[model samples]
Target chain A: MSRPAGKSKLVRGAQGDWEVVIGMEIHAQVTSKAKLFSGASTEFGGAPNSQVSLVDAAMPGMLPVINAHCVAQAVRTGLGLKAKVNKKSVFDRKNYFYPDLPQGYQISQYQAPVVGEGKVLVDLPDGEIEVGIERLHLEQDAGKSLHEQHPTMSLVDLNRAGVALMEIVSKPDLRSAEEAKAYVTKLRTILRYLGTSDADMEKGNLRADVNVSVRKPGAPLNTRCEIKNVNSIRFIGQAIESEARRQIAILEDGGKIEQETRLFDPAKGETRSMRTKEEAHDYRYFPDPDLLPLELDDAFIASIAASLPELPDEKKARFVKEYGLSAYDAGVLVAERETADYFEQAAKGRDAKAAANFVINELFGRLNKAGIGIERSPVAAEQVGTILALVAEGTISGKIAKDLFEIVWEEGGDPRAIVEGRGLRQVTDTGALEQVIDEIVAKNPDKTAQAKAKPAVLGWFVGQVMRATAGKANPQVVNELLKKKLGV
Target chain B: MSVDAATVRRIAHLARIAVEEGEVEKLKGELNAILGFVEQLKEVNVEGVEPMTSVTPMQLKMRADKVTDGGDAAAVLANAPQTEEGFFLVPKVVE
Candidate 1:
């Protein structure tokens, strides 16, 4: 993928002008039933220490047993990103000392990562941008260190320890805050569609370590600062903008930007330096002596590729070309795999454009307001199909169909039955509609005279007639009758 | 593959290590030996070979996104080197 052309001078320091260089390392938790090395349930919300297994807790003499399912998920995720999946990979010990990290070092991928060289297409307001994927490596997450519960003593939760994490590194291709946010969003959508990870930022299931630096346009990249573990998309954008401006300001003055690791203060919307940046050797990374190199064959890689589902980009393109959906509509439907599936099933054997409109505007709008996912929608795909069927057969007008949708959402009944039971069926009888229009025109003679003189005033008469019949009157019949009665 | 003394010192500084000047020569030799071993990897025809990131080619396990109680603040702060008002306290840098 081509990188965005650099424009606008971002130079901040006194000696020379500069441009901002940005890259990201995102760690996403894999969606699996058990921990990476143990059969301990990967269920969240258990009491502290309840979810910990012997291996997870790093009990004496407990050897790590690699979970096969976690491996498959990693392969699936790599394939979903269109990355090269290495048949064989190795685990190394990334030595570091922190309260949350047990065993004094984390077992992670180093020199040999399982996946390599992929691209993610980020949809911006202007157009779609493809960001290059440097690599996606697997590692185990450390436990949480709780510092807020007590005034004097700190506690640790081992629940997250030994959980699998895929550290996806991206090339320094992003230029603006919007692009960075879009990149993460698109990556999350892809991961979710692959069924490999939940990519939930709230639960720390997905987090980003942003690398930011500022330099003159076309100048050598500045020493970048690493912002660690930003968990929200909004914060990711804020951090990039604030940090870039901060660098620009510092350079505009006489000071130099320091290379360090920083943390984003979401409340303040600023990035504060945590510590000086550490090089690869700082962690003293070495091949883990306890574990052996993993080796696989072509057959394994082929099987993983075969099991791969349609990715987000592929589905979006299909929706555009095959279903005749607008880019925006296609994007909305394909953002979530389940939502896309719901739309496809609802649109089956129906007017594709109409189905797209109903699914995107009406159904999705209602679902968003109700705070429900497509999977948990009260209006099932089959029910939507039924509703669209009714509309297609002209049994109910579009206006009445919307009313029936509300009834279906609340009562969870058949669309046809709801329309019949509530007597909300469209009044297609031209005579009845004409009679209602005549009565409305007779009651408002002055308005009818004005409408006859000005043809645009026909909507007023149509509204009055529809209101009299409680919106059940067929709109086409009412319009025709109103035009005839007014004699424009 | 041999790392020079200056390169060793630079790496140490990058890693935030307060290495004594006298030890730079010794560390340089050690680093050189390590890099020599790593250089052997280049000899193998890995033109089409992909880099490995993890053993067993597995993903890290994840949990459902719902937020649960991260547990009591007091319990978490117990391990802090210093604390005040239920938050970790580093040396105050500003007034």
Candidate 2:
């Protein structure tokens, strides 16, 4: 079979080019105080079983009661995704037996999910692309089974059991690993902005099950293998690349791909078969006998929509329009909710593009090196605002602002106070600057005469004056002073 | 499809129930009988009735979002078959 016309070029293989189709099922823990169906705490790092309630532990005759706030959070997330919130959705029992699952069956949505189709706009290097979300369902988490805790026995931690989770399934729309990574990054940003979940992959709050398959270009879709529970974004890309190569090898050798579940071994950088479809559980899914259908009112959906904070995309657009920032700068500032808030606070009623330069170029670069988040920034937003104000008012040179930033970073203090204490103010006084320029004019008569003749040489005198005054001279004032002294 | 010996064995294994070789025949018969009984529900002529997940005509009971339970380690560990250092112990699960 030949490759499809108008489709992107497929990955080159030994025999021919092969197309890879990728989909992701992301499980993000809902930001809530208690479990989905119990009063137990959903806080991480709790002692084993200490956070478990009777319902979570599956005590006989203990019934599960849904957390109202968790349901609302799920609705909020659906709205954030621009998904359809199903007014009526049913919970089913997915029958499986695992040591971590105290109940033999997990309470999940099988047929009717809470949220319907939606599309995510992934910002790629070329441009923006849309990834379709098939459905999002509410489910309960299983507890942790730790085998490393004991030599001959496993230990169970029930703290995470029954916690609310949203399983977001995507269509097979991703064309490459880079697109997959961008899709996840955009989804995480949206979720964090909605305040529905922290979506911290490091904290185990968000993880993805990646499904990978490869086909002869323009051929029918091939059987897929799911790479299970890849938590980190880097590993997701690695998993896809390795799994695609594996599938291509199998297909080139005239072997059909088997449907299976595989584990991505990060250390080995390969995918190993965890289980084949023949060994998979039937998971006889049926409506849960305990819980009734979840029916949401239009008013409820509207209330959640009304309460949502401005999401990343909207905030980015506003930053570009109102702040006159570059698309790249707006994207960087709005990537995180905290960073966007910080930028808005610092840029409020001021020169926004200048403020953006400081926040994006200076603050973000420092934060990345120091391994800290914008929330843990050494300089406060108000403090940076003060520094930007000083620059705007010409009270301090840009070079002096850098020195002032270094001072505030090391020793916390008011920006104005630090500038005043260290005598870092700009030499905007044209009289004092003119004296310095006059002396330079006498010493470099030849270069001064050349500067008067060829206006480009004026740059050389500007550097000389700046070096003499230690870069504290206001650049515009220095230019005016040099023009007057050189009689250019 | 009718229940068979291999299907019965597989179901038993999935449920983690110990079904001996001698009991497989008996268990298959019992499961087939249950299936036959449930198959009769297809004969009901009600076309427009909504499928019911619960017997009661009520919505799910929702509780306020709060951590009002837990914190009693001893009470939680009381039902465990074995425990050490405040964790429930079981056979090692390598995967």
Predicted structure with the largest TM-score when compared to the true one: 2
Error of 2 at A429 (Å): 3.3
> Taking the tens digit of each residue's C-alpha lDDT, what string does model 1 give over B1-83?
67788888877764558999899888988888888888986788888775565567665332343222233445544555765
The segments of candidate 1 whose C-alpha lies over 4 angstroms from its true place after superposition are: A5-20, A59-61, A276-281, B1-95
The numbered model that scores best in DockQ is 2
Predicted candidate 1 versus true structure: per-residue lDDT over A90-177, tens digit per residue:
8898877665665778999998888888888888777877788898888999987776566555666677888889999999998777
For all candidates listed, what's the TM-score of chain B alone? 0.73, 0.86
The list of candidate 2 runs beyond 4 A from truth reads A1-10, A276-278, A441-457, A481-488, B54-56
Query: What is each candidate's DockQ, to 2 decimals?
Result: 0.08, 0.75
Shift of residue A394 alpha carbon in model 1, Å: 2.0
What class would a CAPRI assessor give candidate 1's docking?
A: incorrect
Q: What is the lDDT of residue A257 in candidate 2?
A: 90
Instruction: Write candidate 2's Cα lDDT for A99-182 as tens digits.
Output: 888888899999999999987888877777778889999999999999887899999888899999999999888877888899
Clashing pairs in 2: none
